[model samples]
Target chain A: MDLAVEVENLTKRFGDFVAVNEVSFSVAEGEVFGFLGPNGSGKSTTIRILCGLLSPSSGHARVAGLDVWRDAERIRQRIGYMPQFFSLYDDLTVAENIEFYAGLYQVPPALALARQSELAEVLELGPVLDRLARTLSTGWRQRLALATSILHRPPLLFLDEPTSGVDPLTRRLFWEVIGDLAHEGITVFVTTHVMDEAEHCTRLAMMHYGRLIAEGTPEEMRTEHVQTMVEVQAHPIWPVLQALEKAPEVVEVALFGDAVHAELRCDLNDAEARVERKLQTAGVAYERVVAVTPSMEDVFVSLARRWERPTAAGADR
Target chain B: MGEPAVSAQGLTKCFGAVCACQGIDLTVAPGEIVGLVGPDGAGKTTAFRMLCGILPPDHGTARVAGYDVVTQSEAVKARIGYLPQRFSLHRDLTIDENIQYVAELYTVPRDEWQSRREELLEMTYLAPFRRRLAGRLSGGMRQKLALVCALVHRPEVLFLDEPTTGVDPVSRRDFWKLLHDLPRQGVTMVISTPYMDEAARCNRLAFMYAGQVLATDTPDNLRRQLPGELMQVRCRPQREAREALKRCSAVRSVEVFGDRLHVLFHGTADPMLCERLLADAGVECLEQQPVEPSLEDVFMSLVSEHGLTATATGNGL
Candidate 1:
């Protein structure tokens, strides 16, 4: 595969804090690559390093075949970045915000005008062009932020939690635009807390305490983390969770809304049957009991729990 | 029975001629967990501000625990705990200091401040780090500290505006657990989130769009509103499957989700449609499954319905 982003022993630190520790990963061209982790797990630090905004404490990274550190200025011109919170001038109109970013890219005046018009249409910002950024809704602000980032038509894009506070529909809409960008061969790298969003990425890497713990496609990660999961919705969730916590077949147990999820190493079909039988014997009236599909949440929970496992005896991944 | 914990009637807010909230009516009962969900600029924050008495509505009326928001703003402030989208805690203060400051602001009894402080810190797992400077804390820790401050006074009603937006999935889960535990203590909560899955945790939910409430119900009810069959289409050569499905006349929307495509159709549209399209496209598949609608599905359906109208008004879908 053609590499769009390449990292080798990438390390970053803030004083004694090892923000990113000898992490390395490669993203293919035209792929949606996700960086997944808990807050402060070095996701942002790594992103900043890739975006040429922050220098690594050690090691090397390349974006689109250019060394990130040695060719920082050149690499920056070909990559678009949208931070966790965009720095848009609240007083400026939507059109002005786009114009400012375009000017920063040093586009010719006539071409800039055409680019601005094209972006306005693509992002639905035409009507709101005259409105101040502060007056736009949170979702619109996000759209405007995305529009500004891609205004330069960079070959690569970096978005950190771009859908953080936008509604699901808006998030979906945002992903659609991202899909379009990727289709046009723009390599996209994004960090997000939403697991469902992970499902949209072509490939993903999960970090924990500054280390890349797992890296794979979403489905692959799910398969590696969850052998099987039995889902049950019952009146008494606490008791159900407690009962499953000690089950030999159960690897992890979590509460999903009102439902109790039991992750098992046993076969899914057999585990669901056994779980139902056990609940029945315990006199639990469950609204539903079925084999649960692996989700991004299940994968992360399993990964987090692995560290908490007592006596790493007889453990198999 | 006498009055709902929070109630709004024809509540609207406008900036000059621009309408932010357009006659939105909502009610939250005592101990109820009501989720206010919408994309950005959906006026979720504006509605939250008006209900908390921080921003006066341009028209209509709102009451919190029978206290009129307009006339009894102070009383409303006294009885509610508000955590805005931005953390308002002083960065210079230590975790304990921040909690103490909020306690003092609420006029929490001097003698009880220490105990309340300890309890809040313990519940949020911040006891060991209580003396840490708020500025030095991690993103998740800072969010937790902000939440601890919000709960230190034990207000009868709590308003959290997109409290878990940028935090990682694990922290998001922990924060929501705190929300669930509060209602048991007789504290009603109104939380705004852009996530659809978060809606599942609430006793009731309101989907907002363009300053309007699109639907209000439990997650289960909202999911039932999806108007057709859904299929999770997985196969080898994923891109080929997506391309083929998009051209099929029966498919409504073919969303590429990681290695699979979420293919939605108006109705049954033939179960063999996926296989036929894939075979014709020469795509080899691992598997495909017909699945139930997820919260995101419901969110997408509503947004698509609204987008048709929103686009009609110059926004373009």
Candidate 2:
């Protein structure tokens, strides 16, 4: 596979804290690769290091065929980055912000204007082009930020939680634009806390406590880590979960909405048999029962819990 | 429980000539969780502000626990706990200090303050981190602390504006679990969220867009009302399948979802059209089946029905 980004035991230290501890990964060209983790899990640190905005204390990273540290300028030219925090000039008009970034990237004045128009159409910013960036809605600001980042037509993109504060509809829109860019052979790397957003990625890496704990497609991660995932919607889920806790096969039980999802270490057939029998004996009104496949959330939680075991230390941290 | 804890009739607000809220009519019954769903700038925050008595509406009326929001603002404020999008906790204050401050602000008796603070700290898992500065905590921890602060006064009604926008998945789960428990203690909550999955947890939800309620019901009910049927089609070379579906006359919307494509078609569309189209396109590994629409699907359908394209529309958080 053609490589878009390559990292070798990347490490970053800030005083006593090792922000990113010896992580390694490579993305195939045009792939949407995700860095998944909770807040303060070192995802931002890794992305910053890869973007050449921060120097890694050890190891190396290459972006778009340029060394991240040694050829920072060349890497910057080939990559577009949107940091976690909103980075646009709040005081500038939407059009003015795009033009400022275009000028900074040295896009030709005439070409920049054309690109701006195209981006406005794609992001629905045409009507708000004259409005101050601060006056625009949060979703509009996000789109404008994304439009400015891609104005230079960089071959690689780095977005750190770009959809953080946007509504689901706008977040979906933003992902579509990102997918369009990836379809054009531009490699995309993003970090997010939203699990469903990660489902759209081609490949993903789950990180925790400054280490990469799991990496694969969502399907692969789910199958490998979760044995039996079941969702049961019933009245008084707490009592059901409490009884299930005493069962031998049950490993994890959590409340999801009005439903209680229970994880077991055995296959679905056996787990279902036990659950059905128990609930029937208790005369419960079971709305539904199924041996459901694990959602990205279930997999993430399993991975995090697995990593807490001392015996699994080598594979996790 | 039949009578609403909060009610608004044709509520409207404006900042200068721009309408922030446009005649919103809503009600939140006691012991109920009403999800105030909307894109950013859809006037959710403004409506929430008016209902909570924080901001005076330009027209119409709102009441909290039978107290007028305009004239009896003190009564409205006393009965409700409002958590704004930007939490107003002092950065320099510790978790304990913030909770204490909130209790004082609400005029809780000195005898009851300590126990309430302790219970809140324990419930939010902040007891261990009580001495930590508010600004020093991680995003999830800070959000939890904010929630704890909101609950320390034990107000009868809770209004949370985009409380979980930036929280990690695990914490988001934990937060919602806490919300589910609040009603048992005689507390009513009105929360706004951009996450569709989280919307599933609400007892009832209002789908808002451009300052109007598109749908209001349980998540399952809203999903059943989708105008078109949705199917998840998975196949190798998804591009080929997408192209085939687009060419088929039966298809209405075809959006790429990770490795698969979510194909939407009208009820009158030919059922076997996908198979015939795929066969003609020489697509392999094609798998298709009818599936229930997710909350995201319902959200998209509502937005699209309103002439908003995910590719060319803004959704504020």
Candidate 3:
């Protein structure tokens, strides 16, 4: 299989702080690779290393088969990056922005114009093509930003939470466009806060405190990390939650909709019995307690428990 | 149950020629959470502003905290807490000072707010950061401090407008746990979020689009309302299966979920039919099973039925 991105023992530091610490991962050509981590977890730093925007303090990376140590300039040309917040020209019309990016990316004139029409059609920006971007809503701007980033038809894309604040419908469309690009063999390296969107990635790697903690397909990660989770539905959920919190077998308890999703440290039957006993002791009326497939949210939340929280006295940074 | 914590009927608001929100009917029972779910220009903020008594509705009746939002807006305002999207925590102020300022703004007696402030700070894990200047805090900490300030008055109803849009997964999880604990303390909440997970957390959701509420129901009811059974099929080289599945007449829609396809059938979903199709298409299917429809699945279907376009006219209504 052809590799699109490769990293080995990558590390970056700012004085005493290690931003990306000895991380390693690889993405296959045409794969939708998701990078998952909490804030300050070195996700952006790793992306910068791979995109060749920032030199790694140590170790190595290759983007589009070019070395980051020696071929950053060429790597930049092979990748398109859309950030968490896009800074599109407010004064530029949707079409104007596309045309400008076309020139900036040095796409051939005719090919640029052709891709412009194609992207406009794909993103469904035809009606508002002439409207100034400032007047466009968030969804429109996001689409325009995506269009601009890929105007050069780069084989690889780096999208940082592309659907962060987008409405569900527009967000769905964004993923569809991404899927289409991946199908056409454009490798996508992306980060997202929304868990469902992470499911769109062909494979994923999770980061915590500058270290790669886990890597696999969504299903693999779900089962391996957080075993069968049980969602308990009880009236006056507070008491039930309190009861479950004290239960011995309940590893983690979170509210999933109106239900209390309890991660267990034991077999399903033992855990369920323990949960029932506690709820009964608390006199909470429960609708049901059933084992559930742990969502990516559950897995991530379980994994995100590395909160060696900084106190006022300790927070001298 | 004698009176709803909040209720609205035929809520309409317009800005110039743009009808931001129209003919909306929604109610929040005491101790219940109702979320306004929509994309940009979906008029969630318009309706929210009207409900909060900050913006008057063009044509509507809304009673918040048992007081008319228009005729008795002052009374309503006194009984509610609002955390807008761009909540400003004074950078110069320490976390404690900011909370004190907000308390004074609401004119809560010093004695009344001190305990609540302490409790709020403790719950959000912000107590340790009390002496830290807001400027020195991370984005997540600032957001938590803002929430603590909002809750300083201990209002009966709370309004949070997309409180965690860009907050990281861990912070978001922490923030949501805070939200879940509110109803237990007798505080009803009304929030707006573009995220499906947040939407699911609500007791009821109003899915808004193009300035209208497409559906208002509990997440469970909403999920169950989908007409046909759903199946998740995992296959290698998933794109081929997706294209072939799209051609299958029995399949209503084939949504790509990583390397799996969520096949929503036109009628009763047949797993054998999918396997046969994949077998004929020369695509290898590893696993196939009927699965519960996710909130996104139900929502995407709603958006499709509503005919809301992707561009969605990003007009800031």
C-alpha lDDT values of all predictions: 0.81, 0.81, 0.84
DockQ of each: 0.39, 0.47, 0.52
- Winner on lDDT between 2 and 3 is 3
Better structure of 2 and 3 per TM-score:
2
lDDT, candidate 2, A1-317, per-residue tens:
77989989999999999889999989989999998987778898988888888899999899888898899877888899988775788889999999999999999999999999999987878777877787666777788989999999998999989998887767877887887788788899998888878888989998888898889987798788888988888765545755665777777676765577888878777777778787777666676778888888888877776666475322111
Residue A287 local lDDT, model 3: 83
TM-scores of the candidates, chain A only = 0.91, 0.91, 0.94
Candidate 3 DockQ, CA atoms: 0.52
List ranges where model 2 is wrong by over 4 Å: A236-249, A276-285, A308-317, B236-249, B279-285, B309-317
Give per-residue CA lDDT, model 1, range A195-276, as digits (tens). Answer: 8889888898998878888999887998877788878887645557657767777787766856877788787658878997
- Name the candidate that leads on DockQ: 3
Residue A176 displacement in candidate 3 (angstroms): 2.1
- Per-residue CA lDDT of candidate 1, range B1-317, in tens? 66799999999988765566888999999988899987666778889999999899989999997799999999999999999889877888888899989999999998798898888877787887777788888777788888888888888899999898877766676666666668778889999887766777788899887778998988778878778789997787776788888898888777666556788898884568788889999998778888878777777678777773352122111
Scored by TM against the true chain B, the candidates give: 0.91, 0.91, 0.94
Report per-prediction Cα RMSD to one decimal: 4.3, 3.2, 2.8
TM-score of each candidate structure, all chains considered together = 0.88, 0.93, 0.92
